[model samples]
Target: MTANTSKSTEGAHEPGGFGALRRLHLSYAGEVQGVGFRWASKLTAERVGCTGWVRNEPDGTVTQELQGTPDQIATYFGAFSRVFAAHPIEYVIAEKSDISPIEDERLFTVRF
Candidate 1:
Protein backbone atom coordinates (compact mmCIF):
# COMPACT_ATOMS: atom_id res chain seq x y z
CA MET A 1 0.00 0.00 0.00
CA THR A 2 1.12 3.53 -0.66
CA ALA A 3 1.89 5.83 2.25
CA ASN A 4 -0.63 8.45 3.19
CA THR A 5 0.39 11.89 2.04
CA SER A 6 -2.61 13.81 3.15
CA LYS A 7 -1.99 16.74 5.45
CA SER A 8 -4.38 17.52 8.27
CA THR A 9 -5.20 21.11 9.11
CA GLU A 10 -6.97 20.10 12.31
CA GLY A 11 -5.66 21.31 15.66
CA ALA A 12 -3.95 24.25 14.04
CA HIS A 13 -4.88 26.55 16.87
CA GLU A 14 -2.57 26.81 19.82
CA PRO A 15 -3.06 29.11 22.78
CA GLY A 16 0.26 30.90 22.55
CA GLY A 17 0.60 31.90 18.90
CA PHE A 18 2.32 28.67 18.10
CA GLY A 19 -0.19 27.79 15.50
CA ALA A 20 2.45 26.76 13.02
CA LEU A 21 3.85 24.19 15.36
CA ARG A 22 2.26 20.84 14.77
CA ARG A 23 2.57 17.49 16.45
CA LEU A 24 1.44 14.29 14.87
CA HIS A 25 1.07 10.75 16.10
CA LEU A 26 1.67 8.31 13.29
CA SER A 27 1.55 4.55 12.97
CA TYR A 28 3.36 2.86 10.10
CA ALA A 29 2.74 -0.63 8.84
CA GLY A 30 4.18 -3.08 6.34
CA GLU A 31 7.81 -3.99 6.76
CA VAL A 32 8.35 -1.33 9.35
CA GLN A 33 10.02 -3.45 12.01
CA GLY A 34 13.64 -4.63 12.05
CA VAL A 35 14.46 -2.59 9.02
CA GLY A 36 16.10 0.49 10.54
CA PHE A 37 12.89 2.46 10.28
CA ARG A 38 13.17 3.84 13.81
CA TRP A 39 16.76 4.76 13.33
CA ALA A 40 15.98 6.46 10.07
CA SER A 41 13.11 8.30 11.72
CA LYS A 42 15.36 9.59 14.47
CA LEU A 43 17.94 10.72 11.99
CA THR A 44 15.40 12.32 9.73
CA ALA A 45 13.72 14.10 12.62
CA GLU A 46 17.01 15.47 13.81
CA ARG A 47 18.03 16.48 10.34
CA VAL A 48 14.82 18.35 9.84
CA GLY A 49 14.91 19.90 13.33
CA CYS A 50 11.90 17.97 14.55
CA THR A 51 11.43 16.64 18.04
CA GLY A 52 9.76 13.27 18.48
CA TRP A 53 10.04 9.65 19.46
CA VAL A 54 9.77 6.54 17.32
CA ARG A 55 9.30 3.03 18.57
CA ASN A 56 8.46 -0.42 17.39
CA GLU A 57 5.01 -1.43 18.51
CA PRO A 58 4.03 -4.93 19.61
CA ASP A 59 1.44 -5.20 16.87
CA GLY A 60 3.99 -5.24 14.08
CA THR A 61 3.81 -1.57 13.41
CA VAL A 62 5.95 1.44 14.14
CA THR A 63 4.53 4.32 16.12
CA GLN A 64 5.97 7.80 16.17
CA GLU A 65 5.18 11.23 17.51
CA LEU A 66 6.77 14.13 15.66
CA GLN A 67 6.69 17.74 16.75
CA GLY A 68 7.82 20.67 14.69
CA THR A 69 6.70 23.34 12.35
CA PRO A 70 4.50 21.97 9.61
CA ASP A 71 7.20 22.67 7.06
CA GLN A 72 9.76 20.80 9.10
CA ILE A 73 7.50 17.81 9.45
CA ALA A 74 6.88 17.79 5.74
CA THR A 75 10.57 18.00 5.10
CA TYR A 76 11.12 15.08 7.43
CA PHE A 77 8.65 12.98 5.51
CA GLY A 78 10.22 13.96 2.23
CA ALA A 79 13.61 12.95 3.48
CA PHE A 80 12.24 9.67 4.69
CA SER A 81 10.80 8.98 1.29
CA ARG A 82 14.15 9.61 -0.32
CA VAL A 83 15.97 7.38 2.12
CA PHE A 84 13.45 4.62 1.87
CA ALA A 85 13.56 4.83 -1.85
CA ALA A 86 17.28 4.38 -1.85
CA HIS A 87 17.08 1.48 0.56
CA PRO A 88 13.88 0.11 -0.89
CA ILE A 89 11.91 0.19 2.37
CA GLU A 90 8.20 -0.14 1.92
CA TYR A 91 5.64 1.16 4.40
CA VAL A 92 2.21 2.57 4.62
CA ILE A 93 1.16 5.21 7.06
CA ALA A 94 -1.61 3.25 8.70
CA GLU A 95 -2.64 6.09 10.94
CA LYS A 96 -1.97 9.78 11.47
CA SER A 97 -3.48 12.47 13.65
CA ASP A 98 -2.61 15.74 15.22
CA ILE A 99 -1.77 15.84 18.89
CA SER A 100 -0.58 18.32 21.47
CA PRO A 101 2.97 19.40 21.15
CA ILE A 102 5.28 18.79 24.06
CA GLU A 103 6.62 21.89 25.69
CA ASP A 104 10.35 22.47 25.38
CA GLU A 105 10.99 19.35 23.42
CA ARG A 106 14.54 19.38 22.03
CA LEU A 107 15.33 16.04 20.55
CA PHE A 108 14.10 13.10 18.57
CA THR A 109 14.76 9.63 19.86
CA VAL A 110 14.23 5.94 19.33
CA ARG A 111 12.19 4.48 22.15
CA PHE A 112 12.56 0.96 23.33
Candidate 2:
Protein backbone atom coordinates (compact mmCIF):
# COMPACT_ATOMS: atom_id res chain seq x y z
CA MET A 1 0.00 0.00 0.00
CA THR A 2 1.29 3.44 -0.93
CA ALA A 3 0.66 6.39 1.35
CA ASN A 4 -0.88 9.25 -0.58
CA THR A 5 0.71 12.61 0.23
CA SER A 6 -1.22 14.78 -2.18
CA LYS A 7 -4.21 15.52 0.03
CA SER A 8 -2.03 16.18 3.05
CA THR A 9 0.17 18.59 1.10
CA GLU A 10 -2.50 20.81 -0.37
CA GLY A 11 -1.99 24.56 0.38
CA ALA A 12 0.82 23.68 2.82
CA HIS A 13 3.47 24.26 0.16
CA GLU A 14 1.89 27.49 -1.08
CA PRO A 15 3.00 30.83 0.18
CA GLY A 16 -0.31 31.96 1.69
CA GLY A 17 -2.42 28.76 1.88
CA PHE A 18 -4.53 29.51 -1.18
CA GLY A 19 -1.76 30.30 -3.66
CA ALA A 20 -2.26 34.03 -3.00
CA LEU A 21 0.89 35.50 -1.55
CA ARG A 22 1.16 39.12 -0.50
CA ARG A 23 3.93 41.47 0.59
CA LEU A 24 3.51 44.30 3.06
CA HIS A 25 5.87 47.27 3.21
CA LEU A 26 5.33 49.31 6.30
CA SER A 27 7.01 52.42 7.72
CA TYR A 28 6.33 53.53 11.23
CA ALA A 29 7.21 56.91 12.60
CA GLY A 30 7.49 58.31 16.11
CA GLU A 31 9.26 56.70 19.04
CA VAL A 32 10.26 53.48 17.31
CA GLN A 33 14.02 53.36 17.60
CA GLY A 34 15.80 52.00 20.67
CA VAL A 35 12.53 50.54 21.90
CA GLY A 36 12.94 46.91 20.84
CA PHE A 37 10.57 47.44 17.92
CA ARG A 38 12.65 45.38 15.54
CA TRP A 39 12.93 42.60 18.07
CA ALA A 40 9.18 42.54 18.59
CA SER A 41 8.54 42.58 14.85
CA LYS A 42 10.92 39.69 14.29
CA LEU A 43 9.23 37.59 16.92
CA THR A 44 5.78 38.36 15.55
CA ALA A 45 6.72 37.32 12.04
CA GLU A 46 8.28 34.15 13.28
CA ARG A 47 5.26 33.27 15.35
CA VAL A 48 3.01 33.69 12.34
CA GLY A 49 5.30 31.76 9.97
CA CYS A 50 5.92 34.77 7.74
CA THR A 51 9.15 35.59 5.91
CA GLY A 52 10.83 38.95 5.41
CA TRP A 53 13.13 41.50 7.05
CA VAL A 54 12.93 44.59 9.24
CA ARG A 55 15.27 47.48 9.89
CA ASN A 56 15.55 50.86 11.53
CA GLU A 57 15.80 54.01 9.49
CA PRO A 58 18.13 56.92 10.22
CA ASP A 59 15.15 59.24 10.57
CA GLY A 60 13.68 57.46 13.53
CA THR A 61 11.38 55.13 11.64
CA VAL A 62 10.98 51.38 11.56
CA THR A 63 10.59 49.71 8.20
CA GLN A 64 9.49 46.15 7.61
CA GLU A 65 8.84 43.85 4.71
CA LEU A 66 6.63 40.83 5.40
CA GLN A 67 5.47 38.16 2.96
CA GLY A 68 2.77 35.60 3.60
CA THR A 69 -0.92 34.83 3.32
CA PRO A 70 -3.58 37.45 4.12
CA ASP A 71 -4.35 35.84 7.45
CA GLN A 72 -0.69 35.51 8.35
CA ILE A 73 0.02 39.08 7.36
CA ALA A 74 -2.95 40.30 9.36
CA THR A 75 -1.75 38.37 12.35
CA TYR A 76 1.69 39.95 12.00
CA PHE A 77 0.16 43.44 12.06
CA GLY A 78 -2.01 42.58 15.02
CA ALA A 79 1.03 41.40 16.94
CA PHE A 80 3.04 44.47 16.07
CA SER A 81 0.16 46.74 17.03
CA ARG A 82 -0.11 45.13 20.41
CA VAL A 83 3.58 45.61 21.04
CA PHE A 84 3.54 49.23 19.99
CA ALA A 85 0.42 49.95 22.01
CA ALA A 86 1.98 48.54 25.15
CA HIS A 87 4.76 51.11 25.13
CA PRO A 88 4.37 54.63 26.39
CA ILE A 89 6.10 56.07 23.37
CA GLU A 90 3.99 57.61 20.63
CA TYR A 91 3.69 55.64 17.38
CA VAL A 92 2.29 56.42 13.96
CA ILE A 93 2.32 54.82 10.56
CA ALA A 94 4.24 57.00 8.14
CA GLU A 95 3.91 54.84 5.07
CA LYS A 96 2.33 51.66 3.87
CA SER A 97 3.06 50.07 0.51
CA ASP A 98 1.93 46.70 -0.72
CA ILE A 99 4.20 45.16 -3.26
CA SER A 100 4.42 41.98 -5.25
CA PRO A 101 5.35 39.04 -3.12
CA ILE A 102 8.74 37.47 -3.50
CA GLU A 103 8.77 33.74 -4.18
CA ASP A 104 12.21 32.96 -2.77
CA GLU A 105 11.81 34.19 0.78
CA ARG A 106 12.03 31.40 3.34
CA LEU A 107 12.60 33.02 6.72
CA PHE A 108 12.14 36.22 8.63
CA THR A 109 15.19 38.19 9.77
CA VAL A 110 16.25 41.51 11.19
CA ARG A 111 18.34 43.49 8.74
CA PHE A 112 21.23 45.49 10.08
Q: Give model 2 RMSD, 1 decimal.
A: 12.0
Measured on C-alpha atoms, candidate 1 has an lDDT of 0.84
Tell me the tens digit of each residue's lDDT in model 2 across 16-107. Answer: 46547877677777777898988988899999989999999887788888888888878887776677564556776666666777888999
Model 2, global lDDT: 0.75
Q: In model 1, how large is the Cα lDDT of residue 66?
A: 94
TM-score of each: 0.87, 0.77
Rate residue 6 of model 2 by lDDT.
Answer: 22
Cα displacement (angstroms), candidate 2, residue 80, comes to 2.0
With candidate 2 superimposed using the best TM-score fit, by how many Å does residue 72's alpha carbon deviate from the native? 0.4
Write out the backbone clash pairs for model 1: none
Find the candidate with the highest lDDT and give its number.
Answer: 1
Model 2, runs deviating above 4 Å? 1-19, 84-86
